[model samples]
Target: MSAATLLRDVFGFDGYRPGQQEIVEAVTTGKNTLAIMPTGGGKSLCFQLPALVRDGVTVVISPLIALMRDQVRGLKEAGVVAGALTSGNTEEETDEVWRNLENGTLKLLYMAPERLASNGAQRMLRQAGVSMIAVDEAHCVSQWGHDFRPDYLRIGDLRRDLDVPLAAFTATADEETRIEIVEKLFDGHAPTIFLQGFDRPNIHLAFAAKDGPRAQIINFANARKEQAGIVYCGTRAKTESLAKALRDARHSACHYHGGMDADDRRNVERRFQQEDGLIVCATIAFGMGIDKPDIRWVAHADLPKSIESYYQEIGRAGRDGAPAETLTLFGPDDIRYRRQQIDEGLAPPERRAADHGRLNALLGLAEALHCRRQNLLSYFGEDPAPCGNCDLCDKPADVFDGTTPVRMALSAALRTEERFGAGHLIDILLGNMTEKVAQRSHDQLPTFGVGKEYSRVQWQAIFRQIMGHDLMRPNAERHGALRMTPKARPILRDEATIDLRRDTIKSAKSGPKIKQMVSEEDAPLLSALKAKRRAFAEQLGGPAYIVFNDKTLIEMAEKRPKSLDDMARIGGVGTKKLDSYGAAFLAVINGEAAAQHPQRQKLAGRNDGSIYDRLLETQATLSRGPSGTDKPMSCSASQLAKVASQKPRDEAAITRLLGDRAADRFGAAFLDILRDA
Candidate 1:
């Protein structure tokens, strides 16, 4: 009956994660609470734990039926009594749930927000002994939220009618949604609020603007090989196409979308849930209810509708607090398509303007110079420090002064009557000899060749940066005509100089970087590990990396574990995996150990204690897991190799600085082994 007993017996986590205990304590004390946790941050436990500790059945109002079903199943899997009331249920199923509620056998009951609008459903809740109402996806009640659902507006009345304390939770909500949630869900009754920071530091965020997005996605996936991940596309057709392309490239991938038959969708979901390293190329429909937490990465082949949507979508990765990667490939077409959708929608002018503003925020994220993680959190009104985990923070961008070119482009738009789009303006700026330009006599305009200082591509980049700055707005009514805003008037008046990012043009002359080879000391061990993996994959009739990825193999060779337990402590070696392949990997490591002493003679002459100390420090840092992991020695192993060859202290350098993958596979406790060393 105690929280500790419930923690151990029901959920099975030995202790609460940070903020979980505080939230549970607050909710159990019968105070209204608003919990804003990042996705996979255990928002469910904040409510679920309190539900078990409460005296009466706790009613959970969720947005999606699929989400409700998944939550109930998960609760049952954890040996907690839970049920759901949805249209999919039979008469007998309804009776059984109600009977359990009446008999005090059900501790939690999940229902969609729409269910509260039904007369029959209202009657059941009116009679049922409900202690607390917990609203999931609580942001849906706020009209300002991206995923707002109209039915959620009815939930506020339930709080008054039921006269119970309420708790509402969402992974993402801007300041507007947070205020709206307080007003609509709790009737303006202030609740104890917890805004857990939004940064997922374990995720390495990268953005690539390029053509042939499908080819780019395939190449990225090829590097990852058999890692479990999701590829999100804007359309169902793109999802199917990309999935087919991935399959052709020899990856285990399947497509999912709302357009698919129910049976097929279910099958795809099952495969994605049960199998490791299976890629699911899907529309937004595939992720809302999915509870699979170890998704190694999430790639966006196209831009999402809003920053909120982007935040929620990418939040699906690194759920276990492990290192994961996110690569988003977007282009001008994506922006144009989204703009067209907004312009054509049937919303009020104010709402439409708000939507445009939200879209601009998303674009800001794509073009931001600072840390992507920091920018994302700032949009949600949470200012987090620059997370060194993202691509931008890891590698600083090259900024260029664009005041002259930006003014010239804006002048061209104004001189041409602001009737043309980016392509036409670009043509005029670059002194093109197109038929439209010749017919309109636009080549004679004073600003025609003013932007000739920059190349066509550089001019295009200037326009994009101008738009991103919100000094110029695209006239969606005229098929994206360039229109200057009041903000631009000052710039044209020479009040300010605009700075923009330099274009990163992919050169046709450049070749891809070759995959670097492991050091000679590690080569034999790496070969042995790969052979063992191939043999295991052959026995299992699956891809070689499915058993254990190259990342895992690299860690094994670097760490050189001495026992089955030590092998299990290597990254990516799960319990099921260690039992299956641990012995074979250990044997390879042992064989390599027996064969090695390559630098023994050289070590006798030199007293390089400082170098050894630094190596130990680098290993200690890498062993801490990704977010907390220290920067490895700034120099390369090959550089160290020139210094010493005894077991190659350079071998320590060759160790590939084990990433969060090791901590993930081996658990945080195993980091202690390296920490103590």
Candidate 2:
């Protein structure tokens, strides 16, 4: 079949996203290619579609077992024959995959690079008639990439042995990674490269100087209530603390990190996939290969490691092409912390310097006077015009002449023997009487108290802006000591005037106000619904979110659906759910309805025909032997209870309301049973 036919038949996408068609065509023509597309830019299909059209088996080398499993599952769901070999599989499972590969039943095989590092595995690949090698996260081969895997370095040997055209793909990479991939993976040969534009217009980018980051996150979450999202933090502790803070603020938030057990991570992933309005507060570990498309926003509670990491993390949002939002909260300390990490890392001196440069690019992003999106795209070699979507473009900054403060800060750094850090230098400028200052007695210098005209906070802000401007450098060895660069010398010598934008500190009061917009009576119903969800979650031994999300409950409370049809119309209630719990919830609604409006009491009995038996049989059949009753389907009993209590419905409504899973498993069968009844 043609590429377009394969695209429509297998993946169901009407056309290729930008750069996908070219990469697919390159691979189909048997040429080695390196494709660097942004996250959510359809990178997987560039190789997957070509694999289908190509003659031989396409061996995909991926980094994570979870990622491989997810891809395999998605391909299988789309009726494509795919399999993955990972440590998580049982012996029989591995045997089945191998059998399929040997018998030519599987078109694509995904295994980790570590698997290929074994000699026996390499022999197996040779015997399997491997046609081409597709490396996902190709940046891992580059020492310069944020997430470098040493095992990936061995793929170069695999490429030589296979002697087939190889295709490598990554969502984020810099010039250093591009060179490293070509050198290491393609054996020093340049491949057909495609660098797709890294702009995501659906995402509204904004940065907040770190002040009450938790409060700001809460405000943002509340404003966009009932949306699936992620909140990334630098530390595991921060993830836990911020998640707790969000939960305390009544947002349905959970924490995930590498420190958690694998089972817990799996649970988090499942919740993120199945539920809506869940805010996953996590480290970068949480989002490498997630495919959920409806995420509405991504927030950074701490600065990310690099610009590439930042882009990949935020690119998770707005995957469905809907307008989403991103918020990054950073402070000066984040820069210092990142600098210390780069300096202390085991990378060679030159690589360390490159890493530091990469971090500076991120700091530059945070401190840019122009559109943040514009600066970010420029770093990737794409010159996008001022995108009116970002915060800077939406609200133009006010520039201030910083000649006096800039000169004073630069001179103070020089006067302190150029040995002091920003804190000490700021103290010298403002003449603070701290112990370090008094001991230096160099607080006695001519520049001491010269900057008293500006407050200590103001001086600190000026120092950040100056460092961001590259007129100064922080000596990493000396613990981030502020030092005047050559760019600062002319300015301090009065030969050049420095103009800086007046730092725009978004007012704490500027966010949307949270009022009790719903009536006081509705508050009780909301609480009751949440309690019910918690009880159901406890009974099922799952997270509170796995039962029914607070957003769904809130919508139920707001709409007060009187019938099963109305309950199914509530945002998260599906057919299986309406069949199971619609009546229970409707009973509560009707109870409240009778109490509030006696005239509606007769209407409750008007739709009392028995529709519960057919739903129970369908549920029983779906839960039949070996599928395991313990492993609940997406719809839980309590969710069904809520639906049944809310609405009484026929099998047609049940199939319609339960969604695709119910429709697929029991639609026609249940319809036949309901007809007989």
Candidate 3:
């Protein structure tokens, strides 16, 4: 049960990833540890390996059931004994887990924090011979953390009850949150803390001011068509609509939100883990414990609540140390929305103000002038050379002396008694003699028309940057009226200068199209590899990466492995995978047609599954009828799924499936797709 033996024989790795061995050694030596490793930095191994070398079952208090189950599944695959007691499990599954624990067979037992509420939880762990307590998403224990869970507060009690050393892990935590974690979990007792690097260099960072955000998301997804990704939305409704839009684009997409039934959310989680090229449009509800390592990209349709949330969200991609991409879209509306949320929350004034400051920090990152990685890492107290992986590093933003315009906007706000929001303030500055302006006699103000050199849009951009810089803030008490902060006086008095990114004013005007992953000549081979991967995944009822990740497939296409020895040499093709799937994929690369999954075979030549796909797309597009002239009407999920599965052969059959009224709106388009099919 040596760490090196477990690493080699059980996990199939020769050595530890950077920052893992130290953590593993500390945890194995029975030290109370707090390891702040970045996402995808093998945080699980630090605890998992220690559990193997330790004497008793390691009780893991995880925040999400999906994360626990995924870890258990992966551990079992790696020949380790692990089980999770989750609400998602069936009675039979729970019984099996209890049996394992009672028999002293299971080495790791994962449970949600909420399970701590059970009166027997403490006694159960004590009786089960729990050795060490390892808490995942450990920052959740802190109320100041982005995702605070009240149940996590019980961990310190569990630790004292069991009298076992504890180890906590999280990807993001600031000084305040770290102190909060220490106070809550360790009772202010210092632990062996391992502050690992916060940099995820493999994840390409890009941010854009929102411009036709729906189209921007669509274009981003279309470019990486068939890649697995996640789209995070701010609200539940946005997740649904954005998911629908992506589905209309003929991608295998789904939506997840807190509002959905537990089963539905779990289903989406399962699918995202098991299916290749599946895009999940979800709220923040979906990401904390998702262990899917091969997510090629992540996009945010709206701005997140804070920088910690943003960092954690983008950390989901490129987790396997392969190149992954991320794009985040934000606009003035997002800023207002976030500010309103913070202001309206029940938090005290100081906490709310701190929340606003956090939002401003994120805004600064989004509107950053230098390397985004530098700006982001610097926030976490890390300093590194300019990373060429971020959008800013690749294409420096166009900045201009926005001092004059900012001052003008600030003056107009001050002269107006700071009672107006951006819209009214902009109108007053641009000398717009509108109904509101004339009614209020804003036209009579000296500040009026002083900013006529900049158009209304330009003035709006100036104000956004002003707010972004924390020079001005919207007072929710005054119903979002613009008010200058202390930071503004330095600029308004003509004593300080400010620069604004010109591109922020223009918004993200359709940039160059996303480049494909491989050369055109190699694309077909990559497609073949993907096809083989999908088949293997479907047969095994696991994620495609369980067969081979995209990075491995890209290597397969590039290397065109002709033998088992060659396939085994590719990264991610460990002994177990080579033994299980090496020959099959090798046959595919050798130009032999691979067997398709039955589900895939059914849609292989049928207009690319277009008959039903277009039906769904057309129905979603016309859900409100042509030109939105009718009441919102659309097929139910079951109806859409049936059509995709059944593919009715004629118009009469299609009409029978969908009623006449519904058919009249989409019958022709449906039949046309069927004809083409």
Candidate 4:
């Protein structure tokens, strides 16, 4: 069958996503290839579709057992015969996969890289008529990568032993990691390289300085009620606590971390795959090969380790090309924590310094001025026009000339012999007269109180920005002390100037307001479609998106398709899904059926769903007057949601959003709920 025929008939995509066609063609044409497609960029199809065109079974070496199983399950669901041989497999599962492989019925055989170390494994692949080898998470082969696997080293030898063409894929690889992948996977041979654009334009980029972070995360999740999302935390313990917090806030949240038992982790993975709108609060341990395509949002409860890790984590959202949103929270402590982690690792000093540089790059991204998409793409060697989807592009950051303040902070660190951290340095700069400052005799220094013009908080922001610019960094050897790098000398000497975002200096106001995926008029229909999706998912025992993704559902809500034919024309609805779910979903769009799942039934007719129901009711109660005493006044539905989320503290804040008349009527009651909340 032609690739196009397989694409339409088997995979259901009318055409390839950007950069997929070339990689697919390269693999199918018997060329060794390396594709650096971002996460959820259809990397699996690059090899899976090519395996269909190839004559024999394609052996895929994946790093994670969960990843292998998920991919195999997804491929099988699409009518492709694919199986994984993992340690987690039961006896019957292994037998079924072996039978399919021996009979040449399986187009793809998935296995963890560790299996390559077995004495019989190479021989088995040779005898199994393997025509091509695909390496997923190819960066894992590199020792420099965050997720290095020693077993991946055997892949190059297997390629040579089998004498088969190989295709390598990774979402996060820098120049060094790419070189390591080529050296280790291709055995020093260059492959046909395709570094696709890393821009996930559909993901709205946002960042906020950490302030009441747990509340911030809860509010973000509350706004996106009944939508699947992931929250990445830096520590395993934090994941559990955050997950508990989310659950308390009435979200369907679960936690996953490496410290969990294997079965427990697997259960979380399974639930995340099968349940719709389920939030997974996880350490970086999760989300390597998750195939769920309809994740609506992702938020970082703590700073990620590096820029690549941040990109990979956020890339998990908006995979189905529907609009998605992301929020990252960072604090001064997170920077110190990450710096200490790098310094305490066993890596060489140069490597540790490089890691610090990588972290600084991410800090720069968080403090971005112009556009986040443009900033992210520039890191991966692409220079697209400013995508207006990111927070900065949507609402430009408030920036000011920060050269003088940065120089002052740098001067303070310099005069203090670069032995003081932000807290100490800020104390000296703002002339706090702390006991520690006096004990160290820092109050006697010339730079002491020089930055008194700026508050302690502003001084902290200046220092953070200085570090973000890589002009200075925390000295690990000195117990979290701030140290000036050579880059700072130029600024101190007045040879260079810097511009910093003023808003970040004065603590970020709140998370960025994200653009909605659909129009206000279509929101009810979208909710109805989601209700139908949940019913189908519960009945079929799989993720709601596996039946029809958010993109397809949004289109249904927008176009109001009335028949199976109209539904089948949607992007994600295939022949199988259309046959199974088309009529039910169409009934929802056409209002022919009111079969709202119980969970969704609770949210019916409520703006912004249940989390904000109390606030919405309060607004409605006060719509007329304090006691039905005046002409009717009301806030827009969106404004009510905003008030509920922002939880404004006083009448002034409420007045800014609503006019004086509406604020006077409802402002006191709104503040009462906000305070209680």
Task: Flag regions of model 4 displaced more than 4 Å.
Answer: 412-448, 475-489, 508-677
Give a tens-digit lDDT track for model 1, residues 1-677: 99889999888889998778888999999999999998888998899999999988899998876677778878989988899998766698679887898888998999988888888877788788889999999999988778878899988989898899999999988888899999998888789998887777788988878567889999999999879999999999999999999999999999999888767877887788899999999999888888788999999999999888888889888899899999987676677557656654544445655776788777777777678888788888877888898889988877767778788888888898887777778888888878779999999998776666666656655666677677676553332356787778877889888776774421212223335344323543465566667767879999998889988888876666765545656778876676566656666566322221223212222333234334445545655445665433233343333332322222233343433343232223333332443
Candidate 2: count of backbone clashes, pairs at least 3 residues apart or interchain: 28
Q: How do the candidates rank by lDDT, highest first?
A: 3, 4, 2, 1
Q: Tens digit of lDDT per residue, candidate 2, span 1-677?
A: 89999999989989877778888999989899999988888888988999999876889999876678788889999988888888877698788888888788788999989887789999988988889999999999988789999999988899899899999999888787899999999988899999888889999999888777789999999999899989999899999999999889888999999899888888888889888899999998888768888899999988998889999999999988899999999875566557656654545545755666677678778878888888899888888888889999988777777888888888887777776667678777887888778887866788888877766556666766786677776543332345566778789889998767675422212223336424332543454455556656778899977766778877887777876556766877775565555566666555432121122222232231233434555667675423555444444444344334445246557655667775556555555555654
Per-candidate TM-scores read 0.70, 0.70, 0.70, 0.70
Off by over 4 Å in 2: 414-417, 432-446, 476-479, 483-497, 504-677
Where's the lowest-lDDT run of ten residues in candidate 3?
Answer: 596-605
Summarize candidate 4's per-residue lDDT along 359-389 as a digit string, tens digits: 8888888888778888777877788898888
Cand. 1 Cα-lDDT: 0.75
- Top-lDDT structure, candidate number: 3
The 10-residue segment with the lowest total lDDT in model 2: 593-602
Measured by TM-score, how close is model 2 to the native structure? 0.70
Q: Which residue ranges in model 1 land beyond 4 Å of their true spot?
A: 90-95, 411-448, 454-458, 475-490, 505-677
* Residue pairs that clash (backbone atoms under 3 angstroms), model 1: 571-662, 599-646
Candidate 1's error at 136, in angstroms? 1.2
lDDT of 4 at 316: 89
* CA-lDDT, candidates in order: 0.75, 0.77, 0.82, 0.81
